[model samples]
Target: MTDATTTTAEAETAARPWLDASLPVAERVELLLAEMTVEEKAGLLFQTMITMGEDGELAEADPVFGLPSNREFVLEKGMTHFNLLGVAPTAGAIARWHNKLQELAASTRLGIPVTISTDPRHSFTENPGAAMLAGPFSQWPDALGLAATRDAALVERFGDIARQEYTAVGIRVALHPQVDLATEPRWSRVLQTFGEDAELSGELGAAYIRGFQNGDAFGAESVSTMVKHFPGGGPQKDGEDPHFAYGREQVYPGGQFELHLKPFAAAFDAGVRQVMPYYGMPVDTEYEEVGFGFNKSVLTGLLRERFEFDGIVCTDWGLVNDAAIFGQPFPARAWGVEHLTPLERVEKILDAGADQFGGEACPELVLELVAQGRVDEQRLDVSVRRLLREKFALGLFENPFVDAEAADAIVGSAEFRAAGDAAQRASIAVLSNRDAVLPFTPGVKLYVEGIAPEVAAAYGEVVDSPADADLAVLRLQAPFEQRATMFENFFHAGSLEFSGDVVAHVAEVAAAVPTVVDVFLDRPAILGPVVEAASAVAGNWGASAAALLDVLSGAAPAGGRLPFDIPSSMAAVEASRPDVPFDTADPLFRFGHGLTL
Candidate 1:
């Protein structure tokens, strides 16, 4: 190259250094950071949920959740990061919407592309605050089901498939791989976690990260994994979640706080790019009693200094501001720091070393803090640099738009659905198969509850009642005490014991004929009575009716082992330490317990 040509190229680079793909990411980050206004930098600190407009357009507003219009969020507030809420009819719809969102972002002063994140959506659960149901995406068993398979390779494959689907629709971040241990049986969020064993959770969590980030090298193809609930979110007092004010305490009766952190260590080792501290406040531990989001001793001292994690640390939602959920008002989950004002909350979160505020959009407070000298502009630059570097590394600056048409083919493809169905079948754990009655002869008269009669007709004769049938199959959800509030009901916390009515119904069906009962083990249940009544018992996590029948009818092999212990009684669960794994005495079925076909 001639000197004149080199000089021309250098001039072009200097004109738009941040957009030059040839430049190093670090150099590009610095260039972008230097150009960003204080308001734009403030916008980078907040990442909240965004809803799509009708027919894939930008949402005008969501009065239900009290969210501002997408235009106001971007053009007015200058926020760039969003955790996409809800699903569309087709993958093309999502992809088209993403392009539109990116276009809106492209119109910004610096043209910094929006980093779209999502909660786990490729599963059956549809908790608005936590996860979304697999609408257009291929549906897989929940995380616990993956743990039951005990195959790290399969978990990695699932991650890779999910990554492909995510990127096809322009989603750049996964706010998941919730590596918290399910040591507490009544914990509301256990289904999303790999079961009680730390080693297993660690191994699978690492594989999950590898799959999402495309084997540790993050680029355009990668969906950055935000390994979450740092220092662990399990061991909730009485197994209640911290999402509610009443459930704020996180206790460790067994002094096993270190055990709960094992999975996060594995996630960190696997090159996870972001972290989210849980809403729960530590109780009786060496750390401060505030929520992890505001606990500087935990976030800065343990996670940053001890673990040496320099990646983005984001708080779990609604830490600094009170918000309405499902049209019901709830206080901000400030925990021990509730006395602080919203501005003070923001100052504390920044001081605690978190880079971004999850589930909030309050850039004005940041600006105010800066003006008041409570927060320095340099501190904002630190987080802004980290955030910008990620965008550059992800190749978002080069091209934030995705091929919308390709999304229809990639997401929920026939091959992907087939894989998900196979996983669903593989995850059904046969807990008890009395008198070797499982591989039921085809065309046997069957009575069923929960299993759709139309779907069950393929395997056998669909009978009206257990008395008129040769075999009966019933599906049951693991028992949970219903809470008072509507939002609280979504989280199935409280007791793990089934009601008397449920037990009596199961007994009645079993008395008429040999019965097979399958329970959805979202939370481990005291299943001794159910096991005794039924001839065969199976446990599932998000398997469809067809998938369950495929395994029971000998069409596919039963491959799942129990991911956690099934307690013999409620007394056993209450006696066990909240932080200790497999602590329940005389569990009905032990961890890794499964009967083969």
Candidate 2:
């Protein structure tokens, strides 16, 4: 007979079934779920961005979000998942901070290990509250550049490198491989996607998923990938981003809805662990006109039932909660159900079959729903079990902390950086060679734009203007219609045409000297004018100036293909329907348009 008077010390020392690695993961999940309180279960449903003090310690309060202390959020509120934002100065510093954070998690009553997640940090794109700058990580070209390369092997390699870096720093979840089709040329977020082709995007998305998750499961040394914006977020109306009120509705005039689902389907087949729906509302589709998070027809009918995807479904950031960014108030993106209270929004998300609400920290509302009998505790068990299963599958129960020194050594290693540099050079796509003007002589007089003086000096004598030079090399960005607010400017959306001044400047340079023009194609640009004006034209997806120079000088072959078609004009772009892939009529440069010198 067991004595009820046994010491609390003895009970604490006894091994739990959930802690036994020998048991099946499913059994471990059930055992843990049986022991959890409602508060702990509710905590599994919310994931919010967590802030840290500059010294790698828990901040008393976050300056931007005004969030509660890490101690209060984790121990008191029972949050075991967090999205880490901002850059840490060194890999060793971030690793040590992760160790301390894990130690805190281990000290909790149930000793549940925390699982840290991150947005894409391997690229140049920077959103203060979303992505981190590449401090100690290897910087690769943007996702679009990888698409331009058309090398699945290279994409897999990037994924593998990213996995190693993420695992070392205790970031076990990757919130990307975005997988959305870049069918809409003017969409700002296309830089993060794998260009416009369904087959290519799907192929690369699968490779990316395999690289991050490391095969079929979230084992040790793996970072689980969360494939996002399901059923395609690319077919946005008039190319405006859905972040603001004016861009909430996604209109699919082309009736090519099936094309966008291909990448997500491939992601699932590749064993992706999580999915995130976008914030846009589907207008006039078969599904209800609601945000994906609140649309049961979209989340449940399409993603869950039709696709049979059993992975965790999480909503995109801030759908239910109104947030302030840099003192500007942004309303909740609840789309169709704007009239609903925060409580109702939470309920709808759950009912729509999402397991988690992103960019939110309101588990208390979940608890209230259960207390009010609006949600079944048994129903809550489903999401909690799935969440706990992932923690187990990741082998977090066995070990969660990382070796700080190893992290420093492994991250941004010379070999990794070299591979990324090679990829950058490989992604540069030469679009035109008029009169064979490229492959410049080492001592020619050169006029350049968007290239550093020191960098341009290596190829030739860099002149101040076109008239003083024998050749002009200009690098320009794909143009976008500038939005009003500072927050909106960060996203390059709207028009695809270069303004009159930019067009005239390039033309004037070409008139004075034999010009080689290269534009960074983050999105497909209206390049008919630039192509006509320049003696030779080139395009790159996230390639550096050094890489571009290598291609132009014939030091390296331009090995990339145009991932999307270049629009002939702004009029052609507007006449095309948003939903259809490759629907633009008479494209100036067709898909797979690349020229070798």
Residue-by-residue lDDT tens digits, candidate 1, 516-547: 99999999988888988899999998899999
In model 2, how large is the Cα lDDT of residue 532? 91
Candidate 2 lDDT, tens digit per residue, 1-597? 346544543464355668877889899899888888999899888888887666677656776766888888788888988888778888887788788888999898788999899998887654433356778888888888898899999999999999999999899999998998988887888888998999999999999888888876569879989998987889888887788888888888878888889999999999999999998899988998998889999889998899998888888899888988767889998999999999999999999999998989899999999999999999889888888988998998888989988988999999988888888888888898888987777779989899998998988899897899989999998887767777888788888899889999999889999999998887899998999999988887666678889889988887888889888988888988887878889999898888887
Q: Per-residue lDDT for 64 in model 1?
A: 79
User: How close to the true structure is residue 471 of candidate 2, measured as C-alpha lDDT?
Assistant: 90
List TM-scores for all candidates, in order: 0.97, 0.96
The best candidate by lDDT is 1
Off by over 4 Å in 1: 1-14
**What TM-score would candidate 2 get against the native?**
0.96
Residue 159 displacement in candidate 2 (angstroms): 0.3
TM-score of 1: 0.97
